[model samples]
Target chain A: MHIAVEEEKCVGAGQCVLAAMEIFDQRDEDGVVVLLDAEPPEEQHAAARDAAAVCPAAAIAVRE
Target chain B: MSAPSRVVVVGASAAGLSVAETLRRRGFDGQVTLIGEEDHPPYDRPPLSKQILSGEWPEERVWLRDEATLAGLNLDLRLGVAALSVDPADRVVVLADGSRVTYDELVIATGVRARRLPGTDGLAGVHTLRTLSDARALRETLAAWPRLVVVGAGFLGTEAAAVARAMGAEVTLVSDLEAPLSDVLGAELGELLVRVHAEHGVKIISGVVVREVLASGGRAAGVRLADGRVVEADAVLVSIGSLPNVDWLAGSGIDTGDGVHCDEYCQAGPGVWAAGDVASWIHPAAGGRMRVEHRTNAGEQGMAVARNILSAGHPAPFAPVPYVWSDQYDRKIQIYGSPRGCDRFAVTDGSLAERRLVALYGRDDLVRATVGINMVRSVRAARALVATPTPWDSIEQGVTA
Candidate 1:
């Protein structure tokens, strides 16, 4: 499973980081979404998909 | 292990409904059921103080989306049904009618209620406005009561006073502070609000605490001040603040504080999420946890919760630059971002004397937030700045120009 994030639409609300901390991180300054690992392990697929679903800006993309 | 995902949403307000809509929008073909204590469908609450109170807009207009919208999405909406307990361990929500609904995911969007005056019972003309019923009752009372005494000078209290004054009711607005909005907007801006109300003939009483409600014939007649001053009135409107609805989460095994504790993704526990006024999530910027109770926060947080429920992995963190607006006496006050820790402010456009200006709050040489009074364009510009890391020097230069 892979999680792709579009940086343009991200508002840095940090909903994705709460779901999958290993796969996502927020910028220290402005709090924008930073994709730590796009292709997370298969076991973390569910959490990554959730991160994609909850992105307020619709910035996250999930591929399985 | 291939059972269909069952999502049960507790509360059909902005957060819950937004989650449902977001789920369907994201192509989630799962069973989505909404349980609400209110019999009516979810409605927009911000208008309650402005248009609804002023009689400019009707009840139906405040509704966010209608029954057709809900039906189109095929959402199972259980209106007027309250959740008695939430057994997160078993992933089930128990209702007041002894019915239990099991869910693979849950979203808690239960909002807050208006806080009432302490020990002011048995007074006929006392009112607190939060829901549709409260507005309707206050509207009826305002029609009969010639003089209206408002007990607080916060956003709601100020808006109500403006509406009541516009409706030809003599309004006496009392606040614990020397000026209205002192705690939130500071003394300078607070004084501006006081001036605005005074210019409209709304009697402003400041720095006075209400000792007791003076009643005659089991009806409110006036209020007694601690300084031995008596202000007579026909009706009293109490708009102190709100208390988040998190009482039912007791013993539910969910981490609860002043509100339901959630992380950045608005998730409280496994298969459980919360948003709106009742959810306090961690703020990365402030390095603390705070619950924002604004319309914009509710809508955005609700949508975020919806996506989190559909997918198991963490979504992006909920880090919206907080924004809120209030309309009173033909003036709109808009705030972008949080200004709690701001140390300095600079006026960019308009002057305080003109009652039309934009002020930017800065901390550690960065523009943290901006506030505009009757200045919409600047607020939009400020919102853009909040999304980026802009230095205070550049912000000042841009605003001055």
Candidate 2:
């Protein structure tokens, strides 16, 4: 699965990192979301989707 | 998108409504459902303690967005229906009646409730103001009770005391701290708050904790202090603090502490998000986790949450210049930015004794925050100073670019 993030609308409220740290991370300085792997292995698809789902700003998009 | 994804918003207060409105405004045509525990629509809360309590503005005036706004957005609002539980895995929100509504996105803005005095069980005239119902009940009692003993010298307590005093009722403000607002605003400003109350004829009792409510005939008589002092009064106003409403997330697998932990974007977990008083967000500027309970924070954070929800990728971080205001007596106090770790303050525009001035707080030779009392223009200048780090000397000289 591949995830797309809209950086314009993201607030660094790190809900995505909590859900799937391997998939999403936040920039240390401004705390913006930093998607580690846009597309991950099949085993991590659920976590990626969960990361997208819990984003308060709805900034993440997961695609199969 | 096949069809605008279904978004379920829990709580119809400032945070919830702001998210829903921002969703529709951002072209999210999907089914949007807003569920509120209260029967009334989302209303402005800050005015509840001031104008509404003083009878200057009616209850209806506080309604934030009217039915027209809801209809214009093409949003479905479910008022008076409390959300019982949320299943993040299934993306379903369970209502009080056991009905389940599935959602692609969920926003939790349940807010907080007033913490009451424990073991004060059978107090007849004790009151706490949080919701419209509480305010209405207190308003009715104020007409009958001529004296009010306000527990806690915080913002709400002081405001209520001022309103009651304006209504010709005797008010005595009791606080556990050495001065009112000591914990938040520090001892210096806290002492000023106490003096303000005292000058207004509101008796100020500091460093005393309420042991219990002394009652008779199933009604409140007075409060017994930890210092063994019993102050007589007809009614008591408890404004100690607020506890975030996170009980529903007990087994919800979401990492919950004092509040639902969220990143800078205000996300909680997959398909679940939180804002307002219920969100313990990591402040970007401060680099620390803090929960902001102010109305401005709730509205701004809610909008940020909505924008992030509609985006396709990692969105821009939501970082607002945090601001909060309180109205007491004739003074309008405005605070900008986080006031933590400030070692020095400079009075820029006016004198402190005049009670209409601007004060800048600085740390490490950089401006940290600003507090303005009845000085609106200076507050705007101070806000600019907070946004960009400026020297204390420059701030004292009223330098702004």
Candidate 3:
């Protein structure tokens, strides 16, 4: 699975990090999103997908 | 438990919509009906304070989903209709439009309404935000109103004040307590919020109560403070708090005090569940019951309830370390776990002088919650510890590094 994040669109609500911290991280400066892994394994797919779904800013996108 | 062949969900906000969507995602293909009083479809409420009100995001940007996508969900979408009564015994809901919808299962997600300034509701230019129209109306008036008077210093009021000041409007934030959010966040962090607002050019008035809204020519001109002082403003936003929307359930035989009381499973009655601000469930982690008004809690709890509704009685309890965040003056206050009534609180990282720190709420020398001010990564890391309730001395040892 492939995960991509639009950091510019992130408002830093931090929901993604809460849902799936393994795949997402927030900048210390402004809390913009930074993907820890562009591609995740099968075990992390549910969490990565959940992170993308709960984001209020719609910053995360996932492709399987 | 027998599988429900039909379901009726009341309230079309975040929690309600989540219940319906989660049910669909869980493969519940039975008849589903989603009812909402507002004509608009479900929209995100968090941005109403910052992005939408500050004119950074358009009104439609807050919509949860497009009409075509919502229609594709294959659920009966009832908008602009109010549910007058919920008859749990008969498994029927009476609508204001004289319609009766029977269901094998019911989910109450009718979230709270903004508590208005009692006498000021009729006054023009005075508003309380709990809906899309409220934000739209306030945003329109804020563009022209040079001075914004925000009553109450809680999250809603402070956020509104911050956004107004960002728009170059003069803002006066009035609070009855000496420090903002003191009872909830403890005095130190509350005072930090006060300093942050004051440093951002918002005039802070503490320990003063609002007596009544003063009107001029049938319009809100200003407010009359309890101490006989007047704060002039072209528009006033009252954000005292909210009351749960459970008056319709008065004779419904469901246990409700302040909010609908349910077990850890969100079960209010047989085949009936409640979620969001409207449902106060017994928290398994916290050992008490509390209703969470934040959007994240609403969404999580709503989804959990949906799964349990399909669980056929062997359901897991919805116990979580509740997390919520607030953005103001370009800084974010993020909290993990419920910190209300915590016995002890200590700073674990950074310093207050730097406008960045991580504070831990401890109970019995064990960390129960964490709050971060501009220290996102630190708080995010500490969240795992909160799930297990780490000890206080171990946290101090880690902080020494």
Q: Give a tens-digit lDDT track for model 1, residues B1-401.
A: 24338889898887787788888877888899989999888876777777777777667876666566678789888999899889999999999888999998888888898887777765689988888887887888877647999998989999999999888999999998876686677666778888999999999999988888888898989999889999999999988889988888899899998889998888898888898889999877756798998876787788878766655564778887887777788777877876666786777888787878888887888888877787665555566666676788886664552
User: What is the per-residue lDDT of model 3 for residues B323-354, given as tens digits with 9 covering 90 to 100?
Assistant: 78899987799888866667877787887777
Worst 10 residues of 1 chain B by lDDT: B375-384
Shift in Å, residue B217, candidate 3: 1.0
Candidate lDDT (C-alpha), each: 0.80, 0.79, 0.86
Every model's DockQ: 0.03, 0.02, 0.54
For model 2, the local distance difference test gives 0.79
Q: How much does each candidate deviate at the interface, measured as C-alpha RMSD after superposition?
A: 10.2, 12.7, 1.7
User: Candidate 2, after superposition: displacement of residue A37 in Å?
Assistant: 48
- Write down the worst ten-residue block by lDDT for model 1 chain A: A50-59
Say which candidate scores most in DockQ: 3
- Best-first order by lDDT: 3, 1, 2
- Docking quality of model 3: it rates as medium
Q: What value does the lDDT take at residue B371 in candidate 1?
A: 76
Better of 1 and 3 by lDDT: 3
Residue B274's C-alpha lDDT in candidate 1? 92
